[model samples]
Structures are given as C-alpha cells and as structure tokens.
Target: MNGQMELVSARTVKGPDPVPDLAAVDRLVISNSGGKDSIAAMDEAVNLADEAGVRDRIVVLHIDLGRTPGGQSVEWPGTADLARRQAAYYGLPFEVRRLGKWPSLFHRIRARGQFPHLMTRFCTSEKRAAAHRFITEQVNALGVSGRPARIVHVMGFRAQESRARARRPALEVDHRASSGRRTVTQWYPVLRWSEAEVWQRIRDRGLPYHWAYDAGMSRLSCSLCVLASVPDLTCAAGLRPELAREYADLEEEMGVPFRRELSMAEVIRRAGDGA
Candidate 1:
C-alpha cells in the first residue's frame, strides 16, 4: 500500500485517491446492482469495513427500477433478489428504493418519446436521483449533531469498463449528496480491479451472482441498456422476445428507432437469426 509502489503484477491495486478512514464515516452504503463488478466491489468494501471495525455501519442499497407494462423486467430477471441475497451473505442490512413518480422506466421513456442516449442518459440520472433521495433519508434519520454526517457511497465501476470510468478516481467527494447536514463521499473500492480478479474474488467468497452471465451476458445492467453493445442487445432480445417486442412497439409508436444507428426491430431480427 505504498504510494510510490509500482505494483504492475497485481490484478487489483489501489487507485489514485487513498482509501478513506472507514471508522470516521457515520454510514457506509454499498450500491448493489447484482452485477459481477458490483459484487466484487461489495466484497472489497465489506473487507475494509471489517478491518476498520465499522462493519455495523455498512448497509447495502438496491434501486428497483419497475418492470415493463406487461410485467417483464426492465433489468435482468431476479437481479434485485440476487442483490438482497448478496447483502445477506455479508450479514448486512439491505434496503430497496424505487422511483417515486414513475412506475416503470419503460413508462418514462414512452412518455418522453425518446430512448436514453449515450450523451443524454435520463435513465441513469433517474436512478442516481433515487439513490440520492435514499441517502438523504438516511442522513436525516441518523440525526445531525454539531457536525455533518459522513456518508460513503460505494459503487462498482471498473477501470476496464470504459475510458470515462477509467479516468475516475477511487474516491471523491460527492457534492450532490453533500450538504451542511452531511458529507457524502463516492468510493469505488474495486476501481482498479480486473475482470478476472472480480470473478476470482466472487469465487473465493462463495457468493452467488446473477445468472445472466451464464446465459451468455458479459455484463449485467438493464436487460436492454441503450449503452449496451450490439451483441448484448441481440442476446437480450433473443432471451426476452416479449420484452423486445414491447420495446419495438414503443419505437413504432414514437416513430423513432431505439438507436439512431439501429432499431429495436433490427436487433430482434438479429437475435432471431442467431447473429
């Protein structure tokens, strides 16, 4: 853990920001997405919390985006339950918070007549808003004395995911969540971990992960995330044709394609053709 150490051989190494003093935090909230990266992040965070003797402050939080109109899940099936199971494995308290105004993400998209784009990602914004609300509630419930409550919000973003994610520091102050009443810190415990290391960590802990990976998905998030790769979109459409058709229906109604580069119908066709 030397700052000047060049640990090139290690799959997981410390990132730019030094690890925070966990014992000083009032609450440690791990955002669970039921994805492999998230699981890996949770494992690291839990271990650090245990070492700091603040395991009691750790809590897992899951943001439940509602299902499609026809009851099909917007996310991978069983994701929320798996997140709960993960939290249970650590003997940590878990809480689920849903979108307030919108019943489902599909409903929100249809109402707006636009699918979330890479540059304009309302879906992520909404989810973050929900998480923020939940964090705020926790801050309020804890009751502020003379000082701001310290809250560490743990997320699972890996350097290997994308250039944007790669550029992120391991820990930074979350100004959006911070106020006079509370100071929020965004912590990416596994930010420097590799995909292989993530899997190894999960295997070592003997924790169950979302089954979507075994079903051929490399990553897990929304079943048909706008930011997903073509192959992933095709695979998701093939596994969940009914939901794919629903998305196509939305596209047809709005007179817009799912992506400017391609349509949901086209993705469905690719899936059907086994492309």
Candidate 2:
C-alpha cells in the first residue's frame, strides 16, 4: 500500500453539480472499453441508474477504432467480443460502432518520428476524444427523454493517470460542449477509486475485463500508445511478436525513429538481459 492510493468520494466531500439532477438524467452512457476502469465505471453507472430508478434507460457505448497503432485485433474482434460479453453480463443493450476509416491520420502523426510529449497529445484528440465524440453524437441523435441531446456520459478516467485529471472536478460540464449543442454532463463515479478498488469492484460485481491487462498490459491505451515506458513496451513487444514486428514495420514505413535508436526487438532483448 506504499504507492497505492484509493479513490475517495468526490461528491460527498464536494457538493454535486446541480445543472442536471443525478436521478433525472434521461440517459446514462457508460463509455466502456472493456478495461478495468471502464468495467468499474460501467458497474457504478448501472448501480447509480438503478438506485435512481433509471436502470432501464442505461446503455453501453462501445467504439471500434478500425486499427490501433499496434494491430487490428482489438478493433476487428477483440473490442466487439469484449463489449458483447460485458453487455450480456450486465443484461444491458450495447451500441457498437466502427469508425469509417482507420485512425490513419493519427497513426501517421504518432509514427511521424516525434515522441508525443504532453503538449502534442495528438492521440487523445484523434483516438480517445474521437471515440467520445462519436458516442455523444449517437446519444444526441437518439435523444434524451423526448428530443435528441446529450445526457450524462460517464467515463473511467482515474486521477492517478495524470496530474491534470487529478485536479478535475467530480462532476463538470463536458469540456467538449460546443455552442448551440445540448451540453453533455460528465460524471466520474470511480474517479475516487484506486486501481485495487477498481479490480475489487469488478470481482464483487463479477464484471468482465480485457485480457490485455492480465497479460501485463497496463492502462489499455492504443496498443502503440506513446505513453508506454521502455519496460512496458518490451513486455508487449515480446508477448506479441507479430505486433512488435508490425510496429517495427510501421516505424520504417512511417519514417519515424523511436527512442534508444534500437528496434523494439532490441528493447525486449535488453529487458531480459539483466534479469
């Protein structure tokens, strides 16, 4: 427990944002990714909806972003399969959407030879927010209560992930809210939960999770996220040979050079070198 931290109740400690009544939300979109945080968020969403008697109005938003920087398994089959499993387990309806094209532009940028330092979070806008936008539009099109509009979109962003997120208000208007658009209310139920508490909730609620985490992949960003540490990259590259090779090929094709100047294979080799 030395480095471990738990998520405390942000709502009880700080008063709730009253723009939208917690119980009056017409729709509660559980932005599920089949990851630990998403799983925990989904469970919390369901519980909250039921407690508020809006259980029948809750649904799952699953997006398949064609091809990740690593591979397409997650997009073609993995994400879909996991979403199905989660939906069936929760006895809820899941709306699955596959984006029109590959994240070609984003991948091209990430593979453009420059490491994505915090300033150019091209991946966030391209991949993460892109998916969020798609789901929000879908919900708005589907309408809240009577006419289409954004209701409450709950996500699984942990404060421990970043300092900025750690400072986010418990319930805030979706920053992505645009002028003339029905504002999307954002909620963070597991915002205060720790990684261990998230998993425990999954166990307690019997929620399903992606195999990548158990396979030693942490924080299920795109398989080729720039945020990966050398050790994590080595772990993934070794565990997935073809994936590593594909990334190697991508590095060459994109004409971008990764850190250490050595190939991913070399990185993996160095990982086991001292061990």
Candidate 3:
C-alpha cells in the first residue's frame, strides 16, 4: 500500500471526483455487499465512469458467505438478490463468488472449538483472503488474454463509519499486485461520505437495498458477527431463533463460549431481559 496517503476531509468531497486516467484502466471492480454504503459507492463509481465515457468497464462483484448449520444462510436473506438487481439496474455486469464446501462460519467455529475474537478475527481474515483470491484470478484471466490489466478495486468504506476507517486514505496501491502487465489500485470513493449522505445517494438513485437495514441491522456483513452490538445480536436472535440456538448448542458442546465473558445462552437471556 505505497503512496502519499491523503486523508480527504468529508466536508471537502461530498461526491468523489472521477478517476484521472479512466482510459488507462482495464477494469473497475466494485465490491458490492448489498448494503447502503456499497450501493452508494457503486452509484458514485458508475457516475465517475460514465462521465469519463468508460461505463462499459465497470463490474460488480459480490462474495457470498456460505450457510450456517440447519441449512440457513449466515448472510442476510436477499442480499445477493438485491446486489444482482442493482447491477442490472445500472446495466453493469455482475458476478457472485463463494468459498468451497464446509465454508460455513459455524463449521469453522466448531472445528476450531472456539469463536473468533475481536482482536484475533479469523472469520474476517478468511473472507478477505477469498475475495483477494478471486480478484487475483480475474487479473490473471485478463493477462492470459494478452491484455494489460490495470484494476481499480473499489470498496464502500466511509470515514464516518469508524475511527479506524476515518484514518484510511482515499487512494493507495493495494498490497496484492498482479505480475507484469497487471496493476492493482485501491479506491474508496465514499470514504468521505457521511451515513446520511450514503442513504441519500441510494434514495436519489431509487435503488432497493437489502431488507436487513429496515429490520434494524446497522451492518450486513454477517448475521451474527462477533463485532455485533447487543442490540444487533438481539435482533438477529429474534429473527432467527434456530440459528441463535445453534450457537448456544455449539458453545455447550465445546465447553467454550462465543464471547470470553458471556456465553451465547447468557447473551440471549440478557436480550430477553431487555437489559
């Protein structure tokens, strides 16, 4: 990630500027998660590309987190559906990718006999590795076709999301680089966008977002992410009691709780207590 990192102020760029060298870009892959931020990022990316007369080069990629036990998805229902619909709405090509069999987060937790920690996040690492692998494969395919690929990998991270994210640069060279003839660059078009601005952009585009947000979910990465807040976990349990039970059952079987201080059973109990 080499470059003179610039922390663009949110107040300065309500909307992102177009890429300076659109003609030199081979592909502009937008990572879509079917979330508000992702939708807004894609909208901005499309606008930028369209203004530069390179809209055809835009592509959207969605990573599907496999199902949990009892054949239930770990991700929010209709996430992929909305992503595909959004892609079609914008007339951009879309692709969905997933890890191989036994890719379920629950399966990993059971196998490891431990849940992911906030500090040691294996779940996020695994998912990120898979996404990077897919991106690398795409770059390689372009190289095989004798095309010099210069990829602009776009994400939906916003500075207002968190302090850690607020420190992120607007642009930088990604650590993962394709060999000769392939260059990888990272772009956070919505890095300076506020939460309200993100939603405003989605509403302005009249795009249908994932239903999870309406159901009170602040983030849509995982149905029961370790980083989820008390309210988020409670909401998830209410929506999917069986999946929540699976967590408690696993915790009992392994004699290890999902959280260090609280067991899944206790967490659910507290949620029921409305505390």
Candidate 4:
C-alpha cells in the first residue's frame, strides 16, 4: 500500500503465472504463515482484489500449529502475532484456527508415533483439511442468494522452492471442497516469484515480516521441521534450545530419527559446537 507498487498482473496457463478472477469470487481467503513469501502473496492478492473492486471480500487466515509439552512454541515464537500484524497492516479481517481434536501438531504426531516426512506429510494434509473446513463453514454462513458461493483460497507457494511446488499449478478448482452450494478454488498469487522478488516486494511495501528471518532462518515453518536442511535445523536449534530439546526427546521416545539422515540431538550438538 506504499511506495510505487508494482502490482501483480494476470496470466494464462500457457504463458505465465495464473491469477485468479478476484471480482468473480465472493471471498478471497489468504492463507498467511508469517513467512516472507506468504506476506508477499498477501500483498499481491490485496492489490489485485483492490483493482477488481473486491477489496472488502479479503480475509486473512493463519493456522496456528500450537505449542510444545514444555510450554514452548512448536512454531517460531510470535509467528501467529506476526501474521495478525500483517493482516492488520492491510486492514483485513484475520482469523486463527487450531487443530480441533488435538492440542497441537506435536501431540498428533506423538499419538501416531511418527514425524512427518517428504513422502508422507500428514502435517500439511492436516493443516489443509483444517483450512478447508473453516472455509466451508464460512461459505455456509454467507448464504448466497441463488448461486453457489464462489471462493478462492489464496496461498504463498513459489515454484522456486521445491520440485513438487514447482509442479503445482498457480490456479486450480478445489473439487474436494466444492459442492452444490459452494465453488472453491485455490490460488497461489506469487507462485512465479523468485526469492529476490519476494524480498523486494516486502521491502517495497514496508511490511512487517517474521523475526526468524532476521535471526538467520531462511524459511519459517515449525521451529524445527523434518524437511529442513541440516544447517537450517542447526540454526533453529541454536535459536530455540528448549524447543530443540523437546523434539530431540520426542525422537528418542519414538526411536525414530527426526530425519533419515540425522537426529535432532545431532542438530543440537552441531548447534552447540558452532556456538
């Protein structure tokens, strides 16, 4: 909303990044994780919605991962607060949803006796399902007059991040959530953006982003993610020793490594060594 905004442009499937039809949708639900990419995506979505005259339909949502056994955060400290601040910056309605049956993600993982991995990422699945349920509730509450509610679930997933992410389409109809009363679509507004572009956009907008990035974290997810590289894990362990210990202790109890290559204990050791 500040300083020479280079608003995101619409695209075709054969040409470039796909942009959702903001005006056609009754609701634009932005899934912000307090990461830089999500922040940039939110900015892009807002700009496009404003251009489409549907700025009032925008709503920012954050899925809180909950905390650990020792009362420490499972995710980066202040992640939810940062997300709320970002939403407030745009003057958008914000909502936070947590797991219904479980206290936190860690609790669920513990009950299953396994940590989520690349191939079987139940963590992502659970979060996605939770978001869908919340959106469905909203759709039901909107009470569309004669037509199905049109909603777009916006997320921040850049193609440059991973091969799986790169293979994802920028816009797609979410048939799983769609029904006779509601038509749901998923939109990644910043899918084609590079890492530099994301940072540049954040700087241009003068937006408030997560503090973890300033503390040497390249990405923000759980405080310690199994998919993270060793260096990133080490950095996180260095920053949140107690949280690292909880994960390490969980690994010991389950007799399964946090990651196939190494353990959280090893990451903690490396973090200590570097310190």
- Name the best candidate (by lDDT): 1
lDDT per residue for candidate 3 within 1-275, as digits (tens), equals: 21212212223235553343555677788889888888888888788788779898788998888777687787877788889998999999899887544577778778878999877788877666666777787776665455446777888988887788888777766665544556667778888877888888878879878887888888777787777887888777777777788888989999998788767897778667765
With a 3 Å backbone cut-off (N, CA, C), the pairs that clash in candidate 3 are: none
- Model 1 segments more than 4 A misplaced: 1-17
List TM-scores for all candidates, in order: 0.94, 0.78, 0.87, 0.93
Candidate 1 lDDT, tens digit per residue, 184-227? 88888888888999999988889789888988888898999888
Task: List the candidate 3 regions with Cα displacement exceeding 4 Å.
Answer: 1-20, 144-148
lDDT, candidate 4, at 224: 92
Global local distance difference test of model 4: 0.85
Model 4 stretches with alpha carbons more than 4 Å out: 1-15
Alpha carbon lDDT of each predicted model = 0.87, 0.62, 0.76, 0.85
Residue pairs with backbone atoms closer than 3 Å in model 1 (clashes): none
Error of 4 at 22 (Å): 1.1
| Model 2 worst lDDT window (10 residues) | 1-10
Q: After superposition, how far is residue 227 of candidate 4 from its true place, in Å?
A: 1.0
Q: Please, what are the lDDT tens digits per residue for candidate 2 over residues 1-275?
A: 11001112233521352223445455667777777888887787777666667777777887665554555443323756787788778788887655444454335454455545567765455555555666556656665443235467778887877888888866676646422344466777777778888889988887777777777777675555556766667666656656556656655666664443555546546645731
Give the C-alpha miss distance for residue 143 in model 4, angstroms.
Answer: 0.5
Single out the weakest 10-residue window by summed lDDT for candidate 4. Answer: 1-10
Per-residue error for 183 in candidate 1, Å, reads: 0.7
